[model samples]
Target: MILLQINQVARLFGAEVLFENMQLEIQSQSRIGLVGRNGAGKSTLLKIIAGIESPDKGTLTKTKNLSIGYLAQNSGLNSDTTVWNEMLDAFTAVRQMESRLRELETLISTQEIDSPEGQRVLKEYDQLQHTFVEQNGYSYENEIRSILHGFQFDATFYQQKVQDLSGGQRTRLALAKMLLQKPELLILDEPTNHLDIQTLAWLENYLQNYQGALLIVSHDRYFLDKVVTEIYEIARHKMMHYKGNYSRYLTLKEEQLALDWKAFEKQQGQINKLEDFVARNLARASTTKRAQSRRKQLEKMERMERPQGAEKSANILFKIDKPSGNVVLQLEDGEIGYDKHVLAKNITLDIRRKDAIALVGPNGIGKSTLLKSILKEIPLLKGTLHYGTNVSLGYYDQGQQKLQPQKTILKELWDEHPTTPEVEIRSVLGSFLFSGEDVEKTIGLLSGGEKARVALAKLAMNHENFLILDEPTNHLDIDSKEVLENALIDFEGTILFVSHDRYFINRIATKVIELSPEKSTLYLGDYDYYMEKKQEEAELLALLEQDQVKEKSVSAGKQSFQQTKEQQKIIRQLQRKIGQLEENLEQIEEEVSQLELQMTQPDNLNNHFALIELQTTIDEKTIQQETLYEEWEKASLELEQLDS
Candidate 1:
């Protein structure tokens, strides 16, 4: 069943066409991922669907009475209502019906049973009651509470005034309200900004089972791949629909790009051959007729103009410097978190050179604080951290303080690279989405994404050996994020960044850090490895719970003091083992980097013996990394058996 259809949609801003002659249809079960460059009008399109804005041309028709729940990128709350009260307002219709039913009870008490007015009131009351029940009024509160609980929001925060809460908190409250609304069509823009990994996972699961259609405007590729089964690429002022997730879309898009590039080359080759024949033979009187014939053929040949892709999203290739040492950055009993609320415990982390570590946790787990701790901006409650000698550090915040608002694009980088020429400054800015007139714009005038790009461009000036980024992909469009992701993947530096964008993390992160506040468990694995470990942990916990239930019937206690104590001891031991394994893994990773450096050196190329030796060493390092993870996992199982 088609829920809504956008036909011949067109919008213009000052003679520049944002999107024209665009057509798209959203089905009842459709999960569409909207993609475009920064100024391509994705948000405007969403507004049109939500009835918040009108298109200059075309029609948007929906199935009759289709309810819509739109969570705008920045939806402000004016009413002084708490987060919990704000959510409960979605139940207003049922509440009104219930109130009316009570009023009718008063009327029925004063009227005769034989009177027509009393009978009419009684009928209306029954109708209202049925509608109330049909809407699941009985379990709605429980469902709302569960949704809020899933997001890691405590009960105390629920009653806090929305006006008093932070911007991120308001957005979370708005999301909860929308969930309670449960409209037929749900539209979300950049929904993962304030969400933690656990919350994001819960949202992914929620949308997977959602009965409503979803139209998401997000740069988080991980969210898109998990939630969307189809993609709508808004390019060149038109909507191009594709079947499958972002990964498949990437593959098909690359193939199309390659095919177009080849076709353009083939056409150019033919044009050149014809022009050559005409130029070389035109002066010969004997070949005059042939030359004239060739000229006519050239004139008659229908040419295909090459399509120019959006340059804003182009790849920014970089030359990464070599990894330097075995130790990147090591922490000893680090207690990192925000304020007095200690989110992370005794985090003895070791980030080695050439290691790409991604901080993975639910939102508000002080992932950013951990990065800040390493930066020395935030004090570690208890720990010692050391970075290897000659290691450089580059910081990229999603939209944090890096580029000054008053600073011009050229001035921002030129100040850092004083010895560098103006032409080099222009070149760096151009690669980062500021070119020509854009380079002249002050940093204050730039969009969030443009500002982020500028920050990255300036940071690139340092050529840092380690990057600490906090949600670097937040404001970046699909294209810019991809470019940044590719650059990080090829970067030869150690990276410890906090990101909820799983796709970006998966591309660059060789290791992950999962922070569990209540349990204070930190798991180290790559994106996929972390996921696998998570599932295993969940299953283990469930098994433990089942065992406890069995013990309740047999022993009439929650296991025993000795058994419980033993389990706790084993858990701590397992955590220590995992930490040790990570340390070993870092060492192995460093060796691999060293071997690669040796193999790539000019002196070693001619010496096959040395190259072969380095290759063997690299192979050994990989085996060691894998072996450590397997052993760590095995040891974890032994700890789980302590309570048995």
Candidate 2:
């Protein structure tokens, strides 16, 4: 079923038309990704669709009683309520039903069994109870717990006021609440903002199985590829829809652009031929009739507009003036944090020449603090750090604090290199996408993206052999990010940067170092490789824990022969348990299936009591099935460990 339709929609900001005549339809389960460069009006279009803002022209039609949840960029929950209470608000309707059910239960018990009032109360109680079960009233707390855990909020945070949480934590809580609300249509603007890599993975898994439709606007290509099945791109005041994920959309867009250009050129050739014939032959007596006919044909022919090409991207290039030593930097048993509070300890790292390393960890794990310590802006609470001979370092701050707000963009770079000619400085700034009048824009007046470009231009001018960057892709659009990735990939220098962008890390990092509160772990390859290794490590740890438990169960070490027999017996028991759990799950699934079929029967649909009973039974069977599946998985894992 179509949940919403956007027809010939147009929006304007001041005198400028942001977009016009945009058409889109959202079905019940559509997973759409909206992508565009910064200032291309993606968010504006979302607002128009979400009914937060009306279109300047045209109309939006939504299904009757349609529900929509919209999360704007960096918009966090502002309630003074505790985290648990804030989440409880998502189920207000269910809670109200629960209250009604309790009242009916009281009324039913107090009245005579056969009386009219008693019968009415009983019926009301039954119907409300069924709805309560259907709405997951019994399991909603579990659902809340699951989502909160996925967002990295533990039980300890349950009583914490929402207003007291950090900005990023509040943003995560807002998203968690939205997911629990489960609106018919979810419109998110940069939902991935302020999320760590681990939280991002959890969100991707949750959204992939979301019951409602999704309309997401994000610059995280990796996320778009994971969660969305279709791409809607806005560019040049036009919206184009592509039927694929982000990566596939790129390929399909390129192919379509090629086809569009070919068709345009073919039409242009015909137009030229027709004009030439009309102009040359209109004056000739023999061909005058033919020329007039051609002219008439030309006037009636429909012309194709020129196909749009690639948008302008920042021209970023990183170069090294001199080579660094083979061993660029080293830290031994470092503890990083502020003042006397050490956030992480036992950190050690080795940076080699030409290595592109990615630093990653959970939020507040001190990834940035470690970088600052390396730059000497702060001292490491403990341990020795050394820089290799002939190493020249350049740093990119995530906050862009190094930029002087009073200076103009032109002077930002030019002042650093007074010996260079003004034209040359302007040229470098132009490469970073600052041109002509843009060069004179004050640093304070520029947007985050503009400041990033200016900082990068200055970094490139330094020509350092080693670069340390923090969240370098924070404010960049997709195009600008790709350009920066390409530049860093080709740079003849060593790099160690911190970013949550998995795609960027995959494209640029040769090594990945994951920080933990206790120690740092290194992976030999890019983001995907690191994930694979982490999964393997987790499995190994699980198996080791199982072994420890098994060892504790034994009274003493037995002879080799006896131990072998005992181990075989344990494996056989695990296999039997696994089989039993599987059978239980299958039986529960069959029961749920039967209940679902009963729900569709006309007899049950027409009878409120029968329908409610069937729904309640179905919910019970589903819970049982989930429990069985969990047991089955655990038993299967144990059996596999024993066999291995």
Candidate 3:
């Protein structure tokens, strides 16, 4: 059954047309992943379908009883409400039903069907009760609570109000509410923006089992693959449908592009042959009519439009300056964190020119703080920071610094560089997707996304060798992220950045430094390779534990004789385990090195979702490796104790 049908949709912002003559149909139980460059009218189209916004020209049709639930990119909750209360609000209908059911119950016991007043009350009561039960009014709240817990909403968090939670937490809560509403079609915009790997996986599972249709906009390739069964790619002012996941979409797209090329080539060949025949034979009496016929045919033949130029997206075409020196930036013997907590201590860092560094950490572990420390905004408490020769610093603050209240958008950008020409400046700003009237908007009036674009426009001004970026992708739509990633990938200078966007990190990071409560360790590779190394480490740990158990069993036999044998066995095991860890570590490191090099290639970033999964798997591996190493050390010490 068709859940919803959108036909010939057209949305215009100013003079630019978002898309025209676009058509898409949502089937029952279908999952569609909507993808396009930023500013492609995806959100606008979704709103038109949801009846939240009107399209300039379009029609959205849906079946009767087909309820729709939409999740906006922003947190859709009253600031003062508690997390638990917000979820319950999703069931406004159920709340009404419950109240009505209670009222019916009061009259049910006393009313008789035969009495006119009693009959009226009794009939109304029975009908309301049936409707309540049909809607499953009783269990919805309880079920939603379970789902909230699944999304990492602990019971304690339920009492915390919306105003107290982080933006990420609010996004998750909103997701939970939508899940509870149980709409016929669920439209989620940038649903994975603030989600962790675990919560993302949970959502994937929930959606996979969902009976209703779903359409979501996300840059998380892994989440899209795990949930969406179809993809709608909006580009060149048209909607193109693909039959499978992100991988399949890429594969099918490549094939289609190839076929399109071939078709154009074949048509050209025919046109050329016709032209040759006409040129030679047009003067001959017998061939005059034939030439005329060929000319007519040529006129009727439709030529393909040339594909957009190779570097069509960005006009400036980012080119980075050469590295200044060996040491770009370094932190020595540093304690980094705010008051009362230390993020990383007894820490030293050595950064070299042209080395792409990815700053990674869990929420609240202070990756952002560490970035701030490098900027010297946060006091290092007890550390010396150093910079290399002529190392001009270009900063991409996580908040995208245009976030600071200012007069106008143009002024926010202009404040950064006073000398840049207005024409050149606007051209650079346009490359980041800000155009015309957008440059005039006040900083206080700009959306988070608009502010981010303005910040990027400012960053584009500095031709610095060392770029310090903090979540450059936070507000960038997928298209802008890709453009930014491509630019970074092509950049010749050094980069040290923090981002929650795994897709972007995998494409550019030459190294990953995971900031943990225990310690910050460097994984010298791209996201995918890191995961592989971590997996090998986990398996090695598992094997080590098994071997240790076997060694203990052998060590348990006799007092004197067994003691000597046990000691000897212990020596061999220690030697063997140490050798194995060394070997395992080397193997992972080697693999990571190769993968890191491969990630620099353009083809590697093509499948962004694959990279995300690879990162999540790597993170799990790193944790397992840490646990194994701790166990191995403890066991080795005990073996020494037994030897004595």
RMSD of each: 19.3, 6.3, 15.1
Range of the 10 consecutive residues with the lowest summed lDDT in candidate 3:
308-317
- Per-residue lDDT of 381-410 in model 3, one digit per residue for the tens? 667899889788888886655355756767
Estimate every model's Cα lDDT from 0 to 1: 0.78, 0.89, 0.75
The best candidate by lDDT is 2
Best by TM-score: 2
> How high a TM-score does candidate 2 get?
0.86
Q: Which tens-of-lDDT digit does each residue in 1-644 have in candidate 1?
A: 99999999999998989898888898999999998788888999999999999999999999999999888887755559777788789898877766675676567668775689867765675566456556765446556767887767766677788899877777777887788888999999888878777788888899899888999988888888899998988888887888888888888777777888899899999999989999999999999789889899999999987956545464465544655587878887778766666877768677787788887766666778888888899898777888787777788876657677898888988988899999988988877767898888898988888788887887777777888888888788888887888888888778888887877877888888776553234456678888888899889878976564323222346678797666676666776786788788688767766765665576774444454455456557666766775696587667545533
- How would you order the candidates by TM-score, starting with the best? 2, 1, 3
Which whole-number lDDT from 0 to 100 does residue 384 have in model 3?
A: 89
Tens digit of lDDT per residue, candidate 2, span 151-201? Answer: 999767999999999998999999999999999999999999999999999
- Give per-model TM-scores: 0.77, 0.86, 0.70
Off by over 4 Å in 3: 12-16, 56-58, 91-146, 150-152, 164-168, 196-198, 275-285, 299-304, 307-311, 315-333, 339-353, 382-392, 402-454, 457-461, 531-644
lDDT of 2 at 583: 80
Supply candidate 2's per-residue lDDT for 475: 86
Worst 10 residues of 1 by lDDT: 547-556
Model 2 ranges off by over 4 Å: 547-644
